[model samples]
Target: MNTEVPRLSVVVPVFNEQDVLPLFVERIRPVLDELGLTYEVVAVDDGSRDATPVVLGLLRRRWPQLRVVRLRRNSGHQSALAAGLRRARGQYLVSIDVDLQDPPEVIGDMLRLAQREGLDVVHGVRADRSSDSVFKRWTASLYYRLIQRMAGAAIPRHAGDFRLLSRTAVDALVALPEHLPVYRLLVPWLGLPSGEITYTRAPRAAGRSKYPVAKMIRLALDSIVGFSAAPLRVATWLGLIGIGICAVLAGAGVTAHLSGTTVPGWTSLLVALLFLGALQLLCLGLLGEYVARIFTSLQGRPAYVVAFDSATDAEPAEDALCRL
Candidate 1:
């Protein structure tokens, strides 16, 4: 095992990407090799249920620089990425997906920009995403706009998890107490000196996308709730609006009764009840989202459990976790 610190570490969080793993390795390996840097690719397998483990093992044998960290269960993408980031052993760390959407070729440019300009972080922004579906592009646009509005525009427009971070930036991120961090927002919120590298997003090399509509919605909720208290404030406003509406309804009812103009108020009463009920539910749901986060934090559970790590199995548990 090479105990010396490498110049770069690429942290790849992969799920069931058996079909694309080889293709990713073929493309990414050569690019890193050409850089002439002693680097390691930390591939964190997020409890894949397919032949992904087998493929990674085979790839590791051929490419000694490739290290595999297998999680005990299917933790989400961000958790897997966090695991890789914690485990990566390099001076400079780059996080990218195995789907090949973000080109590996631009990595060299990112490193150069970081070195030349003394940037602590380099974001890989999608200059063009023509390959995405119309619905996807529209939703992505809305997601970014909404988040940028709440979290501020310090975050680049089209950047995702594909970015480079200096050791300092990585250490800062790992030091944060958040267990389920939305890195898209958290990284920018760190207020580190950063730059962006634009790349045309490509279609996946192989396999189905791990993120579906449900997961995307979950991610949006996490990003919002984790960063801002705007949801709770919105809930407060809603409750106030509900109270105002009820007050107006009550005054109108009293006037009708006093004037002896009251007939059957059943319809109006039912409508008011339904409206109030919906508002109450909405407020509870928003509050519940926040309460859930607090509960998770209190539990103090690690987001992922490492079943095995090819390179760091011999290292002490504390050192391996990078919690020190």
Candidate 2:
């Protein structure tokens, strides 16, 4: 490892991305090289089941500027990113993914903008996501809109994890006590001098997307529960509505009995009972989600465990020494 701190550290969290690693390196290395800044690429392997670890090992051997940090298990992408951020030793840290959907070339723009404006954070916002599938675009729009309504902070409309942070910003993020942090919300909550750079998001260069419907839903839940009390409030509203409906039904039953037209109907009564029961259950589930997060947080577990770090075993070399 270089004893001297680098000017920039580009952190990429990897899962089963064996096929895309080479292509990512091919595209990003040149951008860093042309910038003429001392930099290191810190790729955190989030316990890939494929040959990603082996590929990273070989890449590190040839590309001395590359450093690999392997996690003990698959702890998800955000956790892996947190690991990289904590390990980064640079004046500025840039976090991007290996899929190349968020263009690596934009890093130059982010760096320039940050330096020019004296900003602590530079977010790469997707100006156009026409390249993505219709479903992806729709869900992304909904997620951002929902977060804006519920979260206590204002997250950029179309920003993902592709962002640049100064040392101060990185330190603030790393110091946060969240075990499953939603960086999009947490970063904005920090109240830093941040700017945005617009880019047309490109399609993935290789391999399948890691985030599927289930994972996306999980991410949304984590973000909502971690950063807002809206779910609990919604639960409260549901309970109130259920009570009001029950009272209305009781009043109708009393009026019918007084008028000598009380119809004995088990079906309607059963339906109303079932509906209220279901609503109560749903409210309880929502409260449980928040309670679960609180319980997990109090456990004080590390987000990810690193099995290996290439920097500890390898010597550092000049930036962008290896080329495709």
Candidate 3:
């Protein structure tokens, strides 16, 4: 860890959030001021196509402590987060969404717990998340529990990216080299001195959520395969079960032929074949998913490509991105 200490560094991953920035800054500034601590807001511009950068430029001009990270293109949320963590200088780091759904004031509670309890990471768990749709709530519940059961890692339930980590925790996280990082899983695996604070997750101040069903499925698969080998094990188990079924059916067919009862119902045989074939394919597909992740990792591709950065406080680096 560096000898110089920063009181707090808030890393907000920005997407198409132009409408919310003005209100977000207004709400966050007073809370930080009340804490009476030196802080910096790392607003990560994750290749937003909206006026997000313009708003960030305005904010940076107004508040010198504001630091902006511009990704070369639209990296997913986790990659954008990884980019911000790479550049954070604070002794304690806080990760949040720019939507302002998680109140800025929650940081006060997290910081308080960190100081008083001497914890390495403080998680902000929502006491009530009913603001989300019923389907979303159900899926989220299932996803967290399934990850915990299958992954063998004790990821906190109801904990999103809204959390605070001490310098030690931050260092441990940054040392990890997995090209694809699922932050929720990685934090628990680090095994830090963790604590949780309860809060009400507010509805978004503007715009719909960035995470739709398809994105949620992608994230779930990444978390499961990235952290646990259970999926691969399941693939093995499924193949073994299929073999057992096939052997039993073959024996039955031989017995029928010997007894001279003669096999009847070609439809039944066809049904059995289809069912077994489907199972075989499903198991193979699961194996393929794990193999695909390994192949992607072996390629040594960065999780995110930073086309340009202005974190050093220079003029906007002209778009280095090329069109196809």
Candidate 4:
């Protein structure tokens, strides 16, 4: 085992990525090897039910620098990334997905930029995502715009979780109290000295995409609700709007009564009731989401539980490295 700290750590979160893991290894190993820097690839296995673990074992036999951190269950992608971040023993840590969409070749550029400019964080921005569906492109743009405005940070557009962070930056992120961190926002929110490298996104080299529409929406919600109180404020504004609407309706009804134009009809009453009901329900739902987050924080449950770490001999204790 390489006991010495590595110069760089490449943290890749894996979840049922059996098909793409080999290809990812093929591409990423060469890029890092050519850099001639002592680096470790910390692959966080997020409880893959497939042959991913077996494949990882096979690859690790060939790649001495490859380290595997297997979680007890299928923790989400972000949690797996967090586990990697905490376990990574490198001067600088770079987090990327196992999917080949985000090119591994750009890691060299990011590392060089960070080293050259003394940047604590280097973001690998997607210069072009023409490979994505039109709906995805449009929604991604909208999500970024909305998040940037709400976060009030100059978050680089098209920048996802693909980024490199210096040791200090990684420490700062790990020290955060957030249990479920939306790193896409939290990283930029740190306001660290940063640089950007643009890369054209390629289609997935293998395996079906893990992020479906539902997960994407959940991520947006987590990002928005985690960073800003904008959603709560939205609920408040909606309540005010509902009040104003009720007042206007009341006035109209009073005027009709005074002018003797008031007709006995259930349609208007039913419509008004339905609208108010929907508005109230929406507000309640939003408030419930916030309350649920509070409950989760109070519970203090770890985001992930490490099952095994190849670097360590014994089976890891529950929540040993995942208590954030």
Best of the candidates, TM-score: 4
Please give the clash total of every predicted structure, in order.
Answer: 0, 0, 1, 0
lDDT of each: 0.91, 0.90, 0.86, 0.91
Q: Which model is ahead, 3 or 4, in terms of TM-score?
A: 4
What is the descending lDDT order? 1, 4, 2, 3
lDDT of 2 by residue, 238-278 (tens): 88888998999899989999999987789988999899889
Q: State every prediction's TM-score relative to the real structure.
A: 0.95, 0.95, 0.93, 0.96
Tens-digit lDDT string for candidate 3 (1-324):
133456999999999998999899999989988988888888888999987877787777777777878887898999999988888889899999988889999999899999999999998888899898999899999999999899878788999999999989988888998788999889988888899998999999988789989999999998988888898788788878878988898898899899999757899689888988898788888888888988998999887776545556446633211110
Q: What is the lDDT of residue 67 in candidate 3?
A: 80
The segments of candidate 4 whose C-alpha lies over 4 angstroms from its true place after superposition are 314-324
Ranked by TM-score from best down, the candidates are: 4, 2, 1, 3
- Ranked by TM-score, the better of candidates 2 and 4 is 4
lDDT per residue for candidate 4 within 1-324, as digits (tens), equals 558999999999999998999999999999999999999999999999998887888787789999999998997989999999999999999999999999999888898999999999999899999999999999999999999888798889999999999999999999999888989888988989999999999999999999999999999989988888988899899999989999999999999999999999999999999999999999899889889999999998999999888888553443233332
Q: What is the lDDT of residue 108 in candidate 3?
A: 93
Higher-scoring candidate on lDDT, 1 or 2:
1
